[model samples]
Target: MASPIKVCVTGAAGQIGYSLVYMIGSGAVFGADTPVSLHLLDIPPMMPVLNGVCMEIADCALPCVREVVATDDPSVAFKDIDAAFLVGAMPRKEGMERKDLLAANVKIFKVQGQALDQHAKKSVRVLVVGNPANTNALICSQYAPSIPKENFSAMTRLDQNRAQAQIAARLSVPVSDVKNCIIWGNHSGTQFPDVRHATVAGKSVYDAVNDEAWIRGDFITLVQKRGGAVIAARKLSSAMSAAKAACDHMASWWQGTPEGSYVSMGVFSDGSYGTASGVMFSFPVTIKDGKWSIVQGLPIDDFSKGKLEVTGKELCEERDDALAVCSAAQ
Candidate 1:
């Protein structure tokens, strides 16, 4: 058998990391067919917590995991990594200044990007899962100039999955029956869940429901606000579901996307679908080999265009913030 692929995850002691380590170690994300070795990295203070999680991995005795190592150093953790999931960021706490938080996370990501460029396997794929993931990913991609732009992505698959679930619930149809659901723009409140591209049971979603008011009012709000809803209901941030989306995002990107179907993923924009260049945003994408490419030839109605621009504008703002902050620092 060839050597196991090395999977590195930052922030491996936190809630999402707690959920993700086991899944990745067991080959749940990549599949049992591919053996994996996990490199779990966390901050210094979280080393004890990571040790506890590592003990659990030992007890589980997952054969797919050739080895599991926990560390505090990004350089050591990312060494020879084949795939990396960057889930670490300075989250918003009470009274934290936005600039300060962005600066802190940028510092972390800059070092990570450098380490990945120096030590990871050639063509290593990166997924940023933390808050403000788009800009953080941009920082990493910029710092790691050697890595291909498409190899670094942010997590918008969460927004996409939520969009699909809400659409299925509205029409009282199975989620698998909802086809070609699209989410455009940022992963925040402004993200647009475009049902214009959706078909339920081979019928257009608008034709099935025929309620313009519902689509504009409740449906859009539900998908846009779903992350906050999950936090409110669970009394904690959405972790497992977020991890699941991360899994799906990479799985679809690494494996081939099915024919005639595409998924939403956040990748560096090259002006595709009229998205602004240098801004990272979610687009309807088809993956082949190991890269995600925007699906071509989809008609964008006026409503969808407005939504896309709204979210796209926010993404450009994030890019501006990064450039401004990094420029000042330089």
Candidate 2:
């Protein structure tokens, strides 16, 4: 086999980090064909816990895990990494406002971005899994000017999977029957899960269900709010499923889109459907050669027009907010 690819993850001590490290190390991700060397980056206070976790991983003795190193410094940890997974972020406490949240995350991503610019291998590709993921990724991309813009993406595949599950359950069909569903806009409560474009097996989802009323009043709302439902049902955050979704997202990114279809991800917009450039937003996209490109020339109806507009506007507002904070800090 060729040399092992080096993958680095930040926030290696959080709940998501725990699941992510194992799955990636276990050959569930990055394929069984390729061995991986892992560099886990955590905060200084969390390194001891990460060290213990590393010891456990050692016990697992996964042949795919060639080496595991834990570090609190990005420069030391990310050097020569092939891909970077940004899974660690500060969660907002009760009563914290969006601006405050953005301020805090921007500080973290800024340093990480600069470090990536300096130390990460020139070819490193990054995926940000932290909250406010799209905006956090935008900050990192802005700081890491040397990296190509297309290399930055935020995790919204969980939103896509939730849309699939909700649609399948309501339509009484398996998730395999659900196809072409698009998650428009950001990965928040305002997200629009459009079934109008979705297909069940080969039939249009709207026609497959044959009930526009249910699609309107229930499907979109359910998919958009499913995260809250999971938290309510499990009494804990959605980490395991989120980890699975991350695996799916990267899998699809490296693999080509299915024969004639696409998926959605938070990619840097190019003014499509009135979304501004340089800001990342979710759109129907396909991956070719490990790069995601938004599908062009799709027909957008009046319904999609409104849905995309609402989410697209929210992204612009948040982008401006993040930029204003950066200005004030300077």
Residue 231's lDDT in candidate 1: 68
For candidate 2, write residues 1-330 as lDDT tens digits.
879989898988887888888888887768877899999999999988999889988998888999888999898888998888898888644445556767788778877888999998878878888878889999888889998888888888898888888778877888988987888888876788877778888988888788888787788888877777776777666788888887777768766688778888889999987766777898889888887778888788887788888888778888888887777877
lDDT of 1: 0.83
User: What is the Å distance of residue 328 in model 1 from its true position?
Assistant: 3.3
TM-scores, all candidates, are 0.94, 0.95
Clashing pairs in 2: none
| Backbone clashes counted, model 1 | 0
Model 2: ten consecutive residues of lowest lDDT: 91-100
Off-target runs (Cα >4 Å) in candidate 1 are 92-101
- Against the reference, the lDDT scores of all candidates come to 0.83, 0.83
